[model samples]
Target: MVTGVEMRQIDRYTIEEIGLTEELLMENAGQAFVNHIISLLDKKKARIAVLIGVGNNGGDGFVISRSLLEKGYHVDVWLVPPVSKVKGTARYHMDIYLKLGYQVNSFETISATGLSQIFMSYTHIIDALLGTGYNGPLRSPYREIIEEVNRSHGNILSVDIPSGLSADGNVDEPILAVKATHTITFQCPKLSSFLFPFREYLGELTIVDIGIPKRAIDQISSERFIWTEEDIIQTLPVRKPSSHKGSHGKGLIIAGSQAMTGAPILTAKACHRLGAGLVTLATPETAHQAIASQLIEATFHLCPSENGEIATLNLSNEVLDNRYDAIAVGPGLGRSTKGDFIDTLLTSFNKPLIIDADGLYYLKNFLPSLQMRKGVTVLTPHVGEFAYLMNEPIEKIEKNRFQFSKQFAEKYGVYLVLKGPYTIVTTPRGKQFINTTGNASLAKGGSGDVLTGMVLALIMQQRDVQSAISNAVFLHGKAADYLTRNGWSPISVIASDLVTIMPHVLEQYQYS
Candidate 1:
């Protein structure tokens, strides 16, 4: 996935370097979009409204309208701007469309009632009013047009991206963006398509090649990546026939307080469910009895407690030893006064360390320690926790999820998993892999805890740290998706339900 800016650069490189003309590229993009959406269109009954702006996006719409008319489909090309404003390649295509004996409807003087009547009358509305480069608040007729477009029940297909939505994934006024039933983007998927709130606006997204040179795409180092099913399939860990229980890996989970003991149980169970050969739980001795009964597979290291929360970790003992392959901390371990527990784990643990929940809360105090760590540190934080760590408001973090995540990951030399709708996993080197396997069903209190355990288990098992982290995240969401698809309601699927159904989800890839 490339950012909007990166996509524009590629467009320039394709035209100048590869010698593909702007008109030819627009023609190809239009054809590709038509081919993708043709099945959904009925030549006899489909009344199409191709909304056109005075940009390259409108140029593509002109081609799409001409192509649709040629195919015997009834189409009306509406110019959102005046005829005098349309220039360059967009105007060039408009001339051809008009020469084909097709009429263009100009929205220059159309009233609100007239606009709604036109939009509501159409069976499918193609949003070509704005392109990926368009950002910030919508202005004048565009804003007014979009508000009516949302009210229309017509199946909307946005070209490149929904009008008014920022391709950079920033939402200043998201409510003004067009609500498309489908978005056929050119070259590659835009970054905004994967983000929340905006994802709702862009429905059933498709990426069309538009004949852009592979070299042009390669010229820009698109740090953003998405892991497909094939990637997960190939990366799935294979257990050897002669392998014993120890062959998989051992994981240590330090979580839980007397008040919130279920977090550790959920974490340990998820760790074991994801195929951790040996699982150990380190928590307050007071909480052990509660966590132990629920998660029997894990061995316990009862830590000293102060008022139900773990006060400190006895690092001198074997609890933080070499026998464990990974350690996951901070699911339910509440606020600690000293903050040394997190510091000790960061410094003492030479192996991979996964921190989540309250662990992230404490780690906020030791942000600099992440850079100094000799071992790999993985931080899994939702927007709220991430905001806490960054000491910024949630609004700022939500708007610039990519920028903030990339900065933190690169600066600290740690793998960062910023969890939400489409979970983004970033490496220390600044490469980000956006996960698309899950749905809203995964939204729950313990979902993040389940993810922490999965990350802990997978990192120990998979040789490549990147694959391990991405796979765990993908699978964690996939499990929730599976449950919701079968019979479970989104609200009914709890954290433990995710752990329960994970085997069935993993088995598909494992045995396939």
Candidate 2:
């Protein structure tokens, strides 16, 4: 959750306020890095290369190189800077490494041809050339060295972060970055690992507890965070042994025009799979038979429509009298003329309302009343819909997603689930929960409908809006992650495929 600046602040506080020695932390990092390397690759006479910088990152490298040599493994230490440039604890470690007769080559003195030759001799390479402090364009030998490292056929292990990656995820575009096979970070997860372009550089992220006191981390007031498995597991709804279907939750879905009937079908099915006790489909009369055929378990309500689409978004009095636990509107409802109908429904519906797809399109006209609305409103908007709602350019919104999403959620008094990589889930009070699960697989159509249904189902079961919605987002992504982990290509997967496999994923969380 911490930015690069915040991470530096925490590090300083750990060393100064907590009185933890920097030398000890550096040793811990190198030792842990070496330990992980031994576990990952066979160490019986294995060869490894440690690429070092002039700073503490290189200090960690020197310790690692010496440790590997002591363990009887052939170790090659390549320092990018001259030996004179190495200062403090890094110089201290380099001195010991030289005294032990380990060769430390100056990367500045090597040619591109020499780098390629040296790189080929090692099967494993430790990228300790740069840590979180790296940003902007590559300079001098670091550039050519990284090129050779990438070109070489060796498994890469990055220390803290890949050499060219920024800890803040500030790259305007993807550039030359070390494509690490695994990155072992210290203390907590960094911002770069969770962000889009930078995330690609981090292959398999491993956060090691480098003994930074929890009190030091607590000083960081960064409210943003990526939800973990424990956070999701703790928020999952517990089913009681004695509870009946009626006690689980009741949900009503107002979606699916005759032409776009797949949206409501996906949403309703997702709701049932997500543990909705009772679900009723309130689609256009013309779309009822098709939706009903695929959804036999759900009851149906054929609402008034003209030309296979709903004429208005108003709810019928009979449906309102039934008092459903939750209601989600606007997934594939097609185009509809909005007047006072949305206002009437928002006031009268009087339950948890999840607006997605076409609903987001409709809600764009009523942004003023969103703050004054009586019921809880959850808006699941993609970049385009959110841009329409805010009347901002797509480019501008994407660049400042966190800031824009937080403002909209707080100003409108609604829970905004802006769907994207590490989807930002922000509450009206400015609590941000970044979802880390899922991938590009969920980018297909009908995915939002499934997520909307999951949120609606959870809201019906749980009273805490943040907990319900956050868990829904996490579970929705977990389903996609589950599919991808099982060899289903993200590109080949469909929304229905997510719904089909989601129950099995949910089953894993049952007894947790």
Candidate 3:
């Protein structure tokens, strides 16, 4: 989960301090890639074309070409640059590869059509033309070669990163990048592989350890991380045999309007499904009859209504006064002209509070109050909502999401879960986590509501509050991932389906 810059630092530290030579690391990287892709290689018919640049990535291609040649696989080393341009450690590897009696052909001599035909003849195209250092628009032979590689029918394997793709997660011209079928990145994943637009270029990403020591990686400071299954497994709260319904935690979900009763229903369903002990939904009295029979397991506290939306929060009410472990507001709760109750909830609720959907719309006006809250306030905002919250445009926030998310979380003293293709959970202290689970399947109405409920449940259950927040964000996406993998189409996966699929995913992890 290291960025391109952080990875370079680790590589430099490994070479200088850890005593691992550049040549050794390059060889290890090549071998690790070969080991991972060996099963895909067909010695009987495979014609491998290794597209080499003049960088460390090209050094990796030289090792890969030699390794494939020794393994009895037919490999052609195609040099994008002249022999004189290859220098330093990459040139050293090139000399070894040439000394082994394998001649390298320069692509500069080949026509565009000929290059495409040659690439089509190969079964696999090894893309080592560019690495993480590349950004902006492509130029000359590298751009032309990458374009041909993408047009080719061969399965492309990019070394470290797809050629022309930026490793720093900044996608300026993603169209110029090589579309790889499989990218065997060294050590850990590059930040760009997880981002949109650039992510489409990376087919199946595999992180191969290239002998960079854990100590070397640890010495490099990084705030960004990707949550894996192991992280979710370790963070999940356990239900003891002696525990009862009340032992887990109590959660209050104040959501829904007459027109959008399904929002709170979906939220409560997800909350209860995630093992919340006693779940309560407080909505306007007008909407109570609609959702009352829909959720029998949960209790309802009717609130004052104005135009079918909850108009006010009575502080003396038993439901609000209850020592609930967690309280979640705003899922289908309509826009509020008067956010006095929102201000009251912010000041009074001295526990973990999750605000989502219309709640965010209301909370945006009271941003200053969020800083004064005694309880941990979690705001889940999609790009549009976040734009409104920041009083900025969506385009501005999308360009630098990490910076904006961190800044907002730090400024407001609250956890910020910026939801999208890959949800980003940032703490008040600036620690950020990228949830690796989930996909485009989560792009639907009511999905945010379901996530809000899950966050409420996990926040109350897990002892480590931050881990609980991250777990909720990860699992919410995992449920969508599970549904899509198990016969449900991304288009057909409604928000309620996520609530239904979540139990199986949670139980699978819990029992396993």
Candidate 4:
């Protein structure tokens, strides 16, 4: 998704380079909106109110009002901020409204009591009062109009975006904005549609073709990337019938503590579930019984322990001799981890090293030398853990998720999966993927462990590291989404539930 600033650049390039006139584009946009809205409503009986502002957004409203009136929809036009202020292309459309015998009212003409009644009279409200350039709480009439639109029983359709939403919609904080039931955006989705708080306002987003050249959009390199299921289908590892256990990767997951043994077991099980040829859990000797009986298909390497925590010093030469394809560490691991052990793992395990959870905590002190490590490292950290790694405040990291994730991944020379609502999977080669799947359901305790295992399995199976990571993250969220759709509440869907639902998600995604 393009930010408001980047979208403006693409629009400028389209209009200037491609020679598409602004008036013509607005006309096309208005026509496209009218067509979509007609499909959503019965034209003959539909009573529509077009709330227009003084800018190009208002121009689109004027064109919409004219088109709807011509299509036999009962259309009322509200030329907000005074109709006299509407000028240029906007005024041109309003002039046609007057010439064609349609009425247009303004804030100056309509009384507050009458305004409420007029708004309530319409079955649908079209918000054209603001555009992508708008920021924060709207001033005066715009805010008042939006609040009334919200109060009304009308199904609101916003033009371009819900007016008053900050162009930087991806910010964590919530803002007062117009709540659009459906938004028919031109060209591409705006950044607000991708961000939090304000993202909730843009309900049922649809991108309408507005004649902008695709080549123009391809120029945006603001570290913004989107991954789809088709991307997963094309990139996921192909398992041949002739492939043996030796062909698929053997992943070693060193995790779990006495109290947190579930995390390691979850990771190990998820790895095996996702087609890992063999998954070995290297945990403290005491926690072996927990996973050994539950997940009997996997092998276990019991290490010396004290009070249920693994003695990193007791790691044997036999583990190094195993020559696993991928190794993941850190989930459910207590603070007993030593730097020498991490260094040994870094130096010994030359394949993909996925560090998550407590692994990030253990690796914090070794941050300076992370890039100098010998393997393909992947660090998966939630915002808090990520903030600690950067030695910055959590607020700062949360506010700049994409930038911070990208900088950290590039600086540390590791693929960073900054997990959150829209997970940021940043590759060392400067590519940032904004994952669009999953929901609040995946925000449980053992979710990260499940993700780590899924990533480890994909890395072992697929040689293309970035693609494997991206597909794993996507499928992880899709699993949560599957449970949410099939009778489970987001609150009830546990991390292990995601693991339970993975096969179903994968089968459905592959078939559907």
lDDT against the true structure, each candidate: 0.88, 0.83, 0.87, 0.82
Q: Quick one: ranking by TM-score, best first?
A: 3, 1, 4, 2
Residue 35, candidate 4: how far off, in angstroms? 3.1
Give the per-residue lDDT of model 3 (tens digit) for 1-512: 77778888999999999899999999999999999989999899999999999889999999999999999999998998899999989999999999999989988789988988898898999998888877678889888888888899989999999998888667654267889999999998877776777788899989888888999888994777777788888879989999999887899998999888999999999999888999988899999999887889888888898889998765453446475878999998897447577888887778888999999999977877888998889999999999999988888787678888999999889999999977889999998888888888888899999989889988888877778888988888888889888888899999998888777888877877
The ten-residue window of minimal lDDT in model 4 covers: 166-175
The list of candidate 1 runs beyond 4 A from truth reads: 317-319
> Candidate 4: lDDT over CA atoms?
0.82
> Which candidate number maximizes lDDT?
1
Residue 306 alpha-carbon offset, candidate 2, angstroms: 3.5
* Candidate 3: segments with Cα more than 4 A from true spot: 317-322
The RMSD of every model to the true structure, in order and in angstroms, is 1.8, 2.5, 1.6, 2.4
lDDT for 454 (candidate 3): 89
**Error in Å for residue 147 of model 2:** 2.1
Q: List the residue pairs that clash in candidate 3.
A: none
Which scores better on lDDT, 3 or 4?
3
Q: Measured by TM-score, how close is model 4 to the native structure?
A: 0.93
lDDT of candidate 3 at residue 96, scale 0 to 100:
96
> What's each prediction's TM-score?
0.96, 0.92, 0.97, 0.93
